[model samples]
Target: MSEVIWWKRGVIYQIYPRSYQDSNGDGIGDLNGIASRLDYLAGLGVDAIWISPFYPSPMADFGYDISDYCDVDPIFGTLQDFDRLVERAHGLGLKVILDFVPNHSSDQHPWFRESRSSRSNPKRDWYIWRDPAPDGGLPNNWVSNFGGSAWEFDASTGQYYYHAFLKEQPDLNWRNPEVREAMHEALRFWMRYGVDGFRVDVMWHLMKDEAFRDDPPNPGYREGWPDVQRVLQVNSADRPEVHEVVRGLRRVLDEFPDRVLIGEIYLPIERLVTYYGEDLSGAHLPFNFQLINAQWNAPTLASLIAEYEAALPPGGWPNWVLGNHDQKRIAARVGEEQARVAGMLLLTLRGTPTMYYGDELGIGAVTIPPDAVQDPWEKNEPGLGFNRDPQRTPMQWCPGEQAGFSSTKPWLPLSDHFREANVETLSKDPRSILSLYRALIAFRVQRPALRLGDLRLLPCGERVLAYERRLGDDRITVALNLSSEGQVVELSSRESHRVILSTYLDRQTEVATATVTLRPNEGIIIAA
Candidate 1:
């Protein structure tokens, strides 16, 4: 058998730097701030940290619209601070993963600046620029993931450039070998600084159809859905040629040992698994976000997990994420009680699990005041409920002023319940959600069955989701009560079982009967 990889067995904690901590009192978290909290993360039992984009940007889409790929944003500190952060994280035996946004460059980027300068400029081909349609409208029917047309007209150059997201973020022309080389070099630049890996942003949008064909209108489009979803992005994203770009990225990471490449793909399980590429040469893990959007019910989740497990490529590894910067918090989506069950579910899953920074503390969405609205998505498509500001709020560290996230106010508002739901206060509580997360992560680390075992979905009722993870004699069963009521899951085996951990953090080593009686909104891990 091949040697197990850290990214495969260990948990990854995602820290949105803008909200994690603020060391310089600038109301923004920085690399130095993250470095200071390494001990907290280490104690949380997560194996790695995936920091969101902190590279130089004009803040168009926050840091996602990167202007300089090789350096840190001044607001987040300098390249030296990043190096020290990696060093500190390594000292704590923690791996570091950075978010790589390659699909687009900020309109303020020098490359895009030159590209939009003149039609005959040397860098004009670096971006996806095209002549206007005969109707003098959009180059194609492509819609921006943010809203409206994906093409931004550059009157100075007399052409339109494509942007999968905001118009300020112009898509890079990956078909150009020069652009590919430059982006690959950017990866190497960070790898040399001891960065462990990257979670590639918009991995499927790297390559668009060469012919710039119009995307087909979605037959299932609803009246209130986001404008981007009104049309199927058939020509604008997930193109077959994107695999070649992924393989090239894999080659770049393969030049170094044990470096992981995770693709931020929002496709279906079948299409998402294809990102592993032919012969497993593509991304190491195409992020499985099914749980993020899936209905919070046993039947739906059970089928989703089973289908995802069955869809993995030969050596493809699986990963799970319940919440992130872009979506509603798990706690908000499933309520505070179910979030603990969700934590247990995430950590005990067969493959890697990524814990969103504040989710461990049961931090849900914050009410973003209209005067403080910051997310470009919410601004671009107003009143459509596209606001992500609630989920991207400052991390709740303590009950002190500003929730101990910063000396002053944070870039975004803090949650209303931050005083009660914070790491400082909850860490001392034996039954707190933070305690549950720490216990779950530690439990997963100590159990081989939970770490690298093959999963077998067990028979269970509609309100319960049960699965067994086994590697030889080492076997563990995880059953979660997905609803708000009590659930009893029958066991197939007559062998005695011991309760290893529970979401409430109250039970341990208790022998189980023929059936496991789960409290409302609870999850348990049993050892047989």
Candidate 2:
């Protein structure tokens, strides 16, 4: 692999536009708001920014339900605003990747409206629609990710349409050759507009079972929660044909120089590798989400790290994600005490690193009042207590009105800890988690070993985690304290390891041997 395409080793900051910033007084974030924050992103040392869907939508799935693939929603801004955002981001040495939701479109989309008008319409086959059984029941028992049946009855067509998520988001029929061509055309439109690449939304759900057989029951089911037991199989996704779709998309992207494709696949490490394609031609990165779901302990985390490094196919790149719009923030999950260590682990890992907005500021989840909840998932399951609105609140730029997110009231509440976690406060504090994240990202950019390196785990006890990243002659060793109490890490190699970076409370100058002391949750990167 030529090192020319530096994005391969780059860090991508994901900005959920609705929660990032709001330059307009509409409460919703706009492209201009993103343009205003370019300097902050560039200063964080990220190579690119992956902005989540801002396409024309009915807000059914909060931009995931695209009503128009080619245009920006009025809520976000005009087409000109998007172009300016692309230009400004490029000027700041940051590549821009757009979220491409190719699998489905909002039911209100013009194409879907036309398709459902009549069976003989030219766009009739654009979406998957099948007739129900003689009993008037669904074709199968496939459950939607958001709960309930995956099929929705269309009164106009007298047939059921497939929807893996919300009923309003109808699945596109990849079986239709014309539909595939149209999706490719959408890709071409963006590529011509100077967009670097695409972060495909629900990439594995592009296809469904041809026979539409009922899924088998899950073994993890319990008697108390009938809804939990009903989630037997995600039959609508992970079809065998999904790979061919990815390969075809990759070929289209190959037409443009330095263009890349990334897939959002939440499968295990073994299956996730296949999305990269058989000959290193499919997705440039298939979003390794181990860190997002793994247990945050020394033994479990170490084992997961080793498994991921081993599972990646030869020559295929690996990507790490700590949090996204769907899940809770890491600071809230692992506790604020371990936030710095988590950031170090994320930035130092091989391959690309993607940081969710507000993650660098050590921002935890906020409390969204019941009346303020906008997530359809929580709205549907009343008192279920599973709400994502807390993590999706607007970013805190300052401690002032609206947390400096906007002049008007925000769509959601700000974290009570905003005063302590806001960027304004942490940017000046050297020992803050925000500072540690910046230092780690800067160190990663300057070191090639950490960018494209082979990972090797060193002998360390339960409380101390140690590893070495090596690329050719450059090698960097890292040791982290995983416990609340300090631990002494006695490196097997007694050779002196020059300290390159550290978040330790004590600024120790020298250590004759490889052995070093680490304060609780303290981490150090050394060049051996």
Candidate 3:
């Protein structure tokens, strides 16, 4: 078989700029800090790095509220610094995927300022603004993702602007040709650097209902749930017109070769697959977050993976996301033992795998102090279980104060387990989480079947999730015991096999039978 695209064949490591590393002893992380860790990341065996938004912002929603689309924020670093980091990343044979936020811009943005200056401004149409309803209320019943009404009343302009998130992030009018053109140009600005591609932020929110209609109530919504779920969201997000916008973005992305477009879309498998476009022309990969919400069990995970595999469009490629910046870490959700199993499952699966920063070290969420809380979701709702600060803590680099992430106090607190669970400490231990990740990544690189193969589920008991990856004659079977009790798994191929690697890292025995026993919570990969 011929070689496939880099993204399709290797793992993508996500770096949250503010928490990755700090070079100048400032409490906040900077661009130079990220540049300083290139060697460490390269050693981690990731094919590419996807950095979250580091653009100029007002700190309302962290960097998600972009004030400038063309430049990096000073807290992170200068454009030249970013350029240098990209150069270094490429030199180390690593690709860079920047976070492109298109749904909204910071309220302080020049376009937004001018758009809100007056109703007759030339750029007024760049953002979505509407007259109050007949009773001088919000134009519609849409709700914001961060908890209030989606429309913010502007006392100065006597008009209301729409914001899917914080009011500071005014939604752009994608229906406006000029807005689309400007956003496309933003994509071009990054492309000029010959970077890999973009991970478009809130891809599903790019388009909204054209008629300014009210969203119906959701049957699934409970009175105490987040207000965003109170409505069906039919008119607020995931509109059919989003496909056209994705196609338009795809056209610009296709102008450059081997550059991928990964849309940050959160939808069911059926709707999620459509982002691949009718001809797979939309996003190169629409991040599959099924695992994030799936129950951590053998039968449940097996069904989720198979369902996602079967839902892909004709030429669509699959990608798996175990953890991300928005949600809790894999270790925090599924336990440390299972995080190792998750690493194995993610790497050996049929699609691309993205590892959240510090996940390889089994980093879980840290408790944020009430006074140190920064997430707007937490601030807005207070106790609605919407805070994201716990997952955005500083990385544990070494066994030192501040975890060697910064010389000064970090912007957010570090986990108490930093001393015990850090790169410097784990790199020396054979059975460490970091070691297992490196081994799994290296093994996947050398074995073509594991990287690119067809998946076949094996017959197993309730406690085991088993499957085989086959690429011609080279076939490898994987059996994972999700429960604490041991279980016997029956393999379809009754051939002689050798254990390539195990979670325990000490079980490399040979097998020549159709059935095998997995020790409690153990996962193994066997080659025949």
Give the distance in Å from residue 388's predicted Cα in candidate 3 to where it truly belongs. Answer: 0.9
The C-alpha stretches of model 1 lying farther than 4 A from their native spots are 1-3
lDDT of each: 0.92, 0.85, 0.90
325 Cα displacement, candidate 2 (Å): 0.7
lDDT of 3 at 27: 81
Q: Rank the candidates by TM-score, best first.
A: 1, 3, 2
Clashing residue pairs found in predicted model 3: none
What TM-score goes with each of the models?
A: 0.99, 0.96, 0.98
lDDT per residue (tens digit) for residues 1-528 in model 1? 136889988999999999999999989999999999999999988889999999999998889999999998999999999999999999999999999999998999999999888888999999999999999987889998988988888888789989899999999999999999999999999999999999999999999999989999999999889999989998999999999999999999999999999999999898999999999999998999999999999999999999998999888888999889999999999998999989889988889998898998898868999999999999998898989999889888899999988998788989889999998899889989888888888888787888899999987889999999998888988999998899888877788889989888877988876888999999999987
Give the range of the ten consecutive residues with the poorest summed lDDT in model 3. Answer: 506-515
Q: What's the distance in Å from true for residue 217, model 2?
A: 1.0
**Model 2 stretches with alpha carbons more than 4 Å out:** 223-229, 232-234, 504-514
Candidate 1, residue 4: lDDT: 81
Across residues 1-528, which tens digit of lDDT does each residue of candidate 3 receive?
237989889889999999999998888887899999999989989999999988898878889999999998999999999999999999999999999999999999999999999999999999999999999999999999989899999999999999999999999999999999999999999989867999999999999999989999998887768889989888889999999999999999888889999999989899889899888879999999999989999899999888998999887788999988899888989898888888888888898999999999999768888999989888888987677888889989999989999989999999989999999999989999899999999988888898888899876868899999999888898999999888887767677778889988877775647777788878999987
Candidate 3 global lDDT: 0.90
* Candidate 2: tens digits of C-alpha lDDT, residues 463-512: 77788999899898888787899988887687887776777433634553
Q: Which model scores highest in lDDT?
A: 1
Q: Rank the candidates by lDDT, best first.
A: 1, 3, 2
